[model samples]
Each structure stands twice: as C-alpha cells, then as structure tokens.
Target: MMNGNALHTLKALDPAGGSQVHASPTDRERLLANVLNTSRPAPGPAAGLLRRWRWPLAGVAVATSLAVAVSTYTLFGPNAQPAQAMTPPPLRYAPGSESPRAVLERLAVVALKDTSRVPAGSSLYLKHQGWALSTRIGQIQVTSAIVPSERETWKKADGSMRWKQRTLPPRFQNAHDEEVWSDAGAVGEDPQFTEDATGPVNANDPLNRPAPEEPRAMGKWLLASQEYAGTAEAFDSVAAHNLDELWNGRQRAAMLRFLATRTDVTYRGKVTDRAGRAGQAVSVDSAYGGLPTKYTLILDESNGKVLAYEEELTTTAGALNVKVPSVISYFCFLTARVD
Candidate 1:
C-alpha cells in the first residue's frame, strides 16, 4: 500500500484524475433559497389584503414588530448567552506530564527539527508489524522555509555551536537531475530504495522500474470527508486538521455541511489515561460513502484541548478472491501546557 504522504503527493500531481471541485458558497446558498421558495405557499387572502394596505398601516406594524421583538428578547436572550458562551474543551496534556499528546508532540518537534531544512537528506529505519521493513531509506525532506545558499549557525542549550547547510550535487539540481540520480547505478530504478554504503540503492532493475505516475485530483467527495472530520459538530476540529489538508475540493465542503446538519450523532463518554494525562473519551457514530463509520475522540478534561482522535470506516470487496476488511483507521494527536 502506498504511504499517506506519497498518496497525497501523487494526488497533487494529477489534478484531472479523481480530483473533486466544490460548489461555491453562492451556488450553495442559491440552491438552498430555491428549495425554500419552492416549498413555500403563495400568500393567503388575509395576507394579500394586509399587503395591499401595508403602506397605511406601516407605523402600527412597526410598533407591533418592536413590541414582539422586545418581548422575545426579554424572555429568551439572557439565558441564551450562558449556553452560547460555554467553555471550550481543555488541553490534552500538562507541560510537565507524560501524556500521549506530550509524547506525540515531542515526536513532532524532533521530526520537525530534521524536516525544517528544505532539500536536506536524512535516513530513517521503519518497522511494521514487528518486522523490519527497511534498514535504512534515504529521504529528501522539505519544509515551508525557503532554501538558502549560506550556512547558518546556532548555539545549543548546552552552549555548543551547531551549523546547518544544504547543498545539492551538480547532477541533482532539478527534477530532471533528481530523476537521473534516482535511476543511476547508486539508486537504481526501484520504487523502493535501500541505503547502501555509497547511498540508497534501488532494488529493482533500472530497465524494469517505471516512472512515477501523476496522482488523481481530489474532488467534492473527498472535501466533504474533510469538512465532516473538521468541526465541533462532528469530530473535534483541532484533531481533524491532520486529515483536512489530505482532502480537497467539494469533498471537504460536503463533509462540512453533512457534519453541521446531521442530527443522528450520539456521544458516549469514558475516562482514560492517554500519553499520561487524565482525559475523557467520546465516541461518535456516523456514515461515510453510505457506510458506517466511527470516531473516538479523547479530550483533556482540564484544558479543553483534544488529545487524540481515531476514525474507522467499513469496507467491502467484489469479485476476485480479495479479502476486504470492515475497518480503516485514521488518527491524530495534540498537546499543550497548563499554567
């Protein structure tokens, strides 16, 4: 299976394939207005008569409207404020604690340290299902920071000086150069490469390795999923950011609307220790592509921040001897400090 980041990269490269485009807000509003107007009945006899005499009764109508508005405000507005102003969820972890959110945050910080410099290379060893998948794989990590030609120096907390620099070999300057380097004897032509003494070696024969294909563009459907995952009405918004960028176009919008309008959501709460913070876990059931889906959200009871979330979806298969599993999982983690 393709890794999530790789899948995202492929999708970005192929905008015409499966990409989804969302309807604009104006379009959505127009559709809603059309539905409402079509369903509404024409004015009745009394209403028509009132409309004809509306000009003469304008002052009386205004006074009546003001009276009703004041009455409604006095009766309902004050209580509504308290409900509307309810406190938000708490942070997932206390700065000094060892919660799962803290652990993940630390991991993210470490990962970012290496990834912060664009065009820089690093080697990673990954294991799956208790088996070593790769001893070492070379990666060219990029960041939002623009690449700079000059080296920069910084002092470590311990007072040691460190320097950072990035330099690409003459033959590996551009995409074409990178492609050539990917196919050279050092890296071979394999989609998967293993680090050798000289660098990463592509396991597949150069002649057999195919060029990477462009990814399909995400469409309305995927964007809907993102929106569904992003709001307080559905899953925790903060926890859903990780999945938001992975989806695009209409799918995101539909997901958001679905999450906002759906009323079938049920929440069940439990207490658990995550990372190391005491947190409350809430479970929600929903649907995706008409299939049953579940979301598990863990929120810090004190700080109101979501610590983590997990989403699961059902799957099925047709023809072939394929064994389709009933569940797919997505996850996110968060952390923060408490005063």
Candidate 2:
C-alpha cells in the first residue's frame, strides 16, 4: 500500500488534471487503514521523504495561489480602473512649419470676422519715435539723434483731410554732437497744426480711391501708388509704413491677403519691439537700393495690430568707408483713441 499522505497529495494536485486518486470514500478509508496497520516504514526513510518533498510542495502551493489571485483580479478586483487614452500636447510655434505668408493669411481670416467699423469723423493719431544717423561737421565718426514726432489726420470721404504734426528736439550723443545739431537746426521742436478748410470735394488724390477689398486689386493699387516699386521689399515697406493711415477692417484683411501672395516676405521668428512689446517678427529685404536694407514689421498676434515698423541699414550699407548695422528709422504706433 502506498503512503496515505502521498495519496491525499496526489488527489489535491490532480483534482482537474486527470483521474482521481481515491474514487470513493470507502477506497480512501481502506487505503488509510492499510498504511496505518501494515508496513511501518523505517523512521529514517520517512524523514528523508518528508524533507525531499516539503519545499517542492510549498512552492507548488504558492504558485497555485498566485495564478488564482491574478485571474480574480483580471475579472473583478477592487479599485481596478479602466485605462484612459492619452492626449497629445499642443503644438509650439515653429518657423519652418509655416511661411510668413501663411501666417498673415491665417490672421486675415480672423480679421475679416470683425464687423467693427471706424466711426465717422474719427481721427487717426500715430506717435512716431526713432533715431536718425547723422555725421557731425569736422568729425569723421557718425552719431545718432532721437527724433520724436507725431501725426494726426482726419480723412474725409472726399479726399479732403485735416492733418497736424508735433515735432521734438533731436537728442544727441555728446556735447560736440549736440553743438553741431544745434548749429544745423535740422528739426525744430514745434507743434504744427493744419486742417482742410476746403470742404468735401472729389480730388485726384490716391486716398480718394475706393477701398480695395480683394488681394489682387489691393496689390495692384499698392504697386501703382509706389514711385519705385522695384522689389517686394519696397512694396512691403510701403504697406507697413502706411498701414495705419491706409486701411480699416476689411481693407486691412485685403492687404494682409495680398502680402500672403508675395514670396519675398519671410518669417523672422519672434521679437520684442523697440517699445518692449512682444510680437511676431517679419521682414522683407531689397537690394534695389545701392546697399542692402531690411524693412521689418512687428505685428501683435492677439489683435492683428501693427506694433512697430523699422528700417535697418544692413551691414552692406557703406558710408565714409564704414560698414555697420544701423537703424535708419522706426515708427511705433503707441495708441489709437476713438474721437
């Protein structure tokens, strides 16, 4: 007769794998009696058998428990939650992703949605500040002077308009430069005021033309209005310089869309304007001049506002045998209050 303990162990392990070790209660009792009453094995042999099987039996029990626990968890475990789909992060601004033309096109779409109009009799006031490069008499070195100026204009439908300008004294670098500037009296600190006393009458002024609301028409008008529209940069400069004075809501959209059709407009990343305002930088370069020059415009992304317009004398510009980067002029539109 086999050991009764071994039979019970076999029954437990083979419960589902194969036939049962004890088919009935009577068979199990008979086997147990045979093991207890018949041959008592040597004590040393029994001890050796228990030692050999103890660790293996414990390992099997642990493995079975683990399998059962994993299946239970997969089916119905507490605190188990379904997996969630991951979301991607937002896209960052990359210059290579879109051209400046594309960027302006997108902004134009947003601008055209605004149905707000400039009220009748509204005045367009622009504050301009920049430095002008000047060489002092009897001096070889060049210096710059700050020039602060402003313009106010109320354009009427009939090309007649009222215009005013306030000029300020130019700031010089040193006493010698200041003396030269004073002696020359290049610009005076005077408040100039003027108005169109002539009432509404159609004149042949370019401002009198109907506003262009399409890209091709706007481009044609811009090019025809320029005295030297030889390059895209020159045209772009004209657009930037006259942006505030030229267009309103839908007209501005047309101008922007026109810019998109130009291939020379380049995206110049982002920068802070001279006024320390953050904006997207764009520029057009023209070698049409004797020297290379860059006309840069910074536009506020939030409101489609032109923050600043700059003209930089590139390193290619040589004067007095000196080639250096200099700002020829800049105009920053500080504020516009409705009248």
Candidate 3:
C-alpha cells in the first residue's frame, strides 16, 4: 500500500481534485511514472520559491494543462554514469588570500576593462549546461533523479527572450537509482518542457531592466528584487541567485561592486568548475526554499564572467531525500555572446 501521505500528495496532482486517481491500480502506475517526467515553466525572478512548492513537481500535473502535464517525459538513455564520474569534482572551499570585499572590488575593476559591448539592438545569447534534482516521495522511499541538461537563451533588453533546454543522459548515485529510472521507462529522447518562445518579460524582475552600470544603482536594483527580508545578507543572496539574468560584463561588474559593500559575502578560494574552467569562488549562506543552503558562484578568473552557480544543503535536508551537504542544483555556463 502507498503511504497514506504519499497517496495524499499524489492526490493533489489531480486536476479535478479527485482521489480516485491514486486508488486505481492503473492510475497509480501512471502517477508513479509521471513523477519523473513532468516539466514546468522556466524559472522567472526569484519568487517565493519556498512558498511556491508545497509538493514535489517532477512529473506532476498542473491545473492548467492536465493532459499535457501527466503525459510529459524526461527521457534518458541507458548507460548513464554517476554524476561525479560525468563531471568535474566539486570545488573545495578555503579562505582565499584576498578578503571577499577586496576580491569583489578587484573583479569589478577587471570586469570593467572588458571592451565588449552589446549593440543597441543586439540580443544577448547565453548557453549553459547544468543539472537539477527531480525528486519523488513515497511512504518509505525518497528518490532524487539528477537530470543533466543544456540551455540556450537569447535575451533582449526589452525583456523578451527565447530559449530551449534539452536533458542529457540522467545520472545516479547508486544502482538502486538506476533501477528506478529503468523502471520509469527512460527510453525517450525528448525532455519535458523543452520549448522556445519569446516573451513579454517579467517586468517585475529587478534585474530584468536596463542593467545600470553604476554600482550604487545596481545595489538598489538587487535589493528591489529581494523576496527575502531586507538586509545586507539578503542582498548577497539576491546577487548570488540572479546572475543568469544579468546580460553584460559592465552590469555584472556593477553587481560585484555592490557586493563589495556588504561585509557578509565570503570569498572562497579558487576552483575549477564542472566545465573545467578556472574560477574564483564566493559563497553566501541562505535559507532559500526554507532549506539551509549554501549558494556559491564561481566567476571566470580573468574575465570575471559567472562560470557556474550551485546550491548545496549544509545542515538539514528538509523534505529533500538527498543527504546533507548534497548539491541540489548546479549549472555551468558555457558561452555568453551578443548577437
């Protein structure tokens, strides 16, 4: 018998709010598979993520698209490898010789030296390879499926953008996980929610604007975007989470300059990101998504562009099935260009 709690949560996925879905044997099987393959919209501004997800949504149905949500899939081929074997080792954190403030200030200087400028009407194209954990909860079992994928986006100053993301082969920590994926029928090529569309940008996003080059203005912009309490540390969290939304070198430099003002950000030592690019790492601890997580960003050593960002659980797993100190989500940026 499914745990009453799991059954209850699965019941929440029903578009009609029907309990019969979990009671029927055929429906149960379908729901089990749906947990792995459902897809949602790409992330917008750092909305109340903790408040947003009361339940796991890996392959679950939403109220708006009942048929499509239930039928979606995150395909993975056989012969998936362990995530560690597939990617570079996690960057170790040590106290860098330079203080976080000094490093940020220095990076701001180097970043500004870059002469590359976006044309008045050109779009910013960015491509990154990364993975996020897809979780499923049962009465006695909590499973996380690591889905590695690539994303490419063309973003415009007008807040219009289009992107396509495709999942690569899924990875696991152990054989039991492979069993779960194999049982989930991972034989397809299309990953769910992989689509392309231009947009009326989320105008409310603080970073989704004319990215100011002035450090003080940039600081205010970052603060305006914070969904958390208004504090210096919260400002750090906002800067850490919104790097993907920044379009150009100067804007990022302004961001680093703003971070330099806050005394809370820590300058972690150098690291080779998952993509094998050398970067300087800095981190801030945040209670994001209601979980104790350490968010780290690795910036290209020379150019100061963001190379990767990762979120790892530090103390508690909360409702996550993953172990403490586990990386829940990570992304390695491959290319950013103006076109």
Candidate 4:
C-alpha cells in the first residue's frame, strides 16, 4: 500500500508491549488527536528524522475509533519516548534467466486449473507471518523498529471480516538495533490485543471487497476501488500485502494474468522465502513513500499461490532514519486456504 503508511496498518503492532495501559475514553481520544495532529517531516533532501511512515498509523486510529467498540489503548503517545529505529536485513534474491511475464503466465495456467474453493456461505481463511519497519515520530523521540507477528483473517463474500495478529520475536539488521529494542523492553512479549478482533468490519472499505476472478472484471473493480488502485504495482502489491481479503484460485489466476501485463516487473528466478519454501520471484521497483523500494512477490513453485511479499530499500532510506539497503517490510504466508 502506501509505504508512508508504514508498518501496514500498525493495527496490531505496538512497541509499548507489556501491560495494557487503561485510560478513559476522553484520554484515548485526546491522545489519538494529539498523535495524528503531530506534524510529520518531509522526505528527500529535507531536514528531520522521518515519521511520515506513520501516516497509515492514523488510518489505524480511525479504525479503533469506530465507536470505541473496536479497541482502545494509550500506545506511544506524544509524551512517550521512542527508543530505537528498526533496521531489518534486506531480502536476498536469486537470479533467473526467464522473463517475469513468462513466469506469471506459467503461474496463471496453474491457477486456472486449480480447484481451491470456498463454499458460498463460508468465509475464506488466510494466515500469514509478517513484519514491517515501524517508526513513530512522536514529539519526544523518533523511534524506528520492527515487530514480527503472525496474522490470520477470515472474510465472507458479504464483506464481513475479522482478523487477529499475535506478536512474534522480531529480527533486526544489526546488533545495535537489537540492543536498542532490548534496552527499551520492546520484545514481542504480547503487546497486541488485536489478537481478539472479529467480524462486522467496515465492509464498505474497498480493500475488504472480494476481487473478481477475471482480468476484465477485476480491472473494473480496481477502477472503482481505492485511488491507489489506479497504479498496477500499488494494487498488485497491496493484494499481496493484505492477505485480509479473499480470492479463489480463479481470482488468483486473474491477478496473475493482470500482473503478467505489467512490463515493469522483472523475473528474479527461484528463491526460498522466509518460510523456507521454494518460490518463483517477480519484482517491481517504486520510490514508494519517498524511499526507493524494491517490492518482491514470491509464488509457490507448485501451484502459484502467493508465498510471500516483501519490500526493501534499493538505494537509500530517504527521510527515514533506517540505514540504506534495509528491509522496510515483509510477510510470509504460512497458511492459506478456504476453510
């Protein structure tokens, strides 16, 4: 999605992981307003440690504000200090001789013949393990960090959906990043309560809508979908990024067909994803969120299901405090199926 909206939704990510800090509704509203209203620094040749990545963090705020019926916590308010910046290692891709179009076309063939289906009235289920660089440019201190988590979601055709995410110990690019996290007691020690969220979501949200199973139909869907969907790479990457939505084999095939048409993608040959599963890679480069980023998608070599989606810096971190050539985010699909 928007790289500026770093850490994806940050819906279930919190560096202030420990006990829940209970606060009155007024206090929570006040904190949310204060944090969201905080001025974010500009990127590229600009002055300041970047926190624009937290733009999506504001999106998350609206979610929790869905009538106080969602969730509430006074996490990393302006008064709180950010201890360290998260710098995760970049992905290592293996080379390939074939064209990305050839790889995608081949995968589409496989998806078309597959029989994976979700019963009409039942929900589609998907589970993934992912991590993203999270930086909260709070008033006190700038914090950049990563939190690993396993997330699972269920969505019905009617747009009813719910998701749960649990903290997983994170990995860092260097020892110092780890030290900063440890010193601040920011280990994954169960800081997320999004682990308990459920259905009755904002079904009208474009992302929660089920994508059609044909390229032409999906194109129309995208045209009417979010503004970002206007960009092929953005929409494709977002589909692979948010496993929260549903699509059967046919739909996945349609996605591949559409992707095959994008000339910007390059075939990266074969690679083992974070799940240690063999996969075929296709990548596209974007200066998303002002950081020159390489977005890679790995497909299961056997059936063409998405295995992982990753984003890392290609040249520099831009306005962010993280080092160049570091991974900004990654998600590995450990389980995905209609159940």
Candidate 1, poorest ten consecutive residues by summed lDDT: 128-137
**Clashing residue pairs, backbone N/CA/C < 3 A, model 4:** 85-144, 86-144, 86-145
Residue by residue across 63-114, what tens digits does model 1's lDDT show?
Answer: 2332343334324432111111111122232233343333333333332333
Candidate 3 per-residue lDDT over residues 231-282, each given as its tens digit: 3334344433343354467877987887777666788888887788888888
TM values, all candidates: 0.25, 0.55, 0.65, 0.67
RMSD of each: 29.9, 39.4, 12.5, 13.4
RMSD of 3: 12.5
> After superposing candidate 3, which stretches have Cα over 4 Å from the reference?
1-89, 134-144, 173-180, 187-193, 202-207, 229-246
Error of 3 at 84 (Å): 17
Alpha-carbon deviation at 60 in model 4, angstroms: 16
Please count the clashing residue pairs in each candidate, in the order shown: 32, 0, 1, 3
Candidate 4 overall lDDT versus native: 0.58
Poorest stretch of ten by lDDT in candidate 4: 42-51
Ten contiguous residues minimizing lDDT sum, candidate 3? 135-144
Candidate order by decreasing lDDT: 4, 3, 2, 1
- Displacement of residue 42 (Cα, Å) in model 4 is 25
Clashes of 4: 3
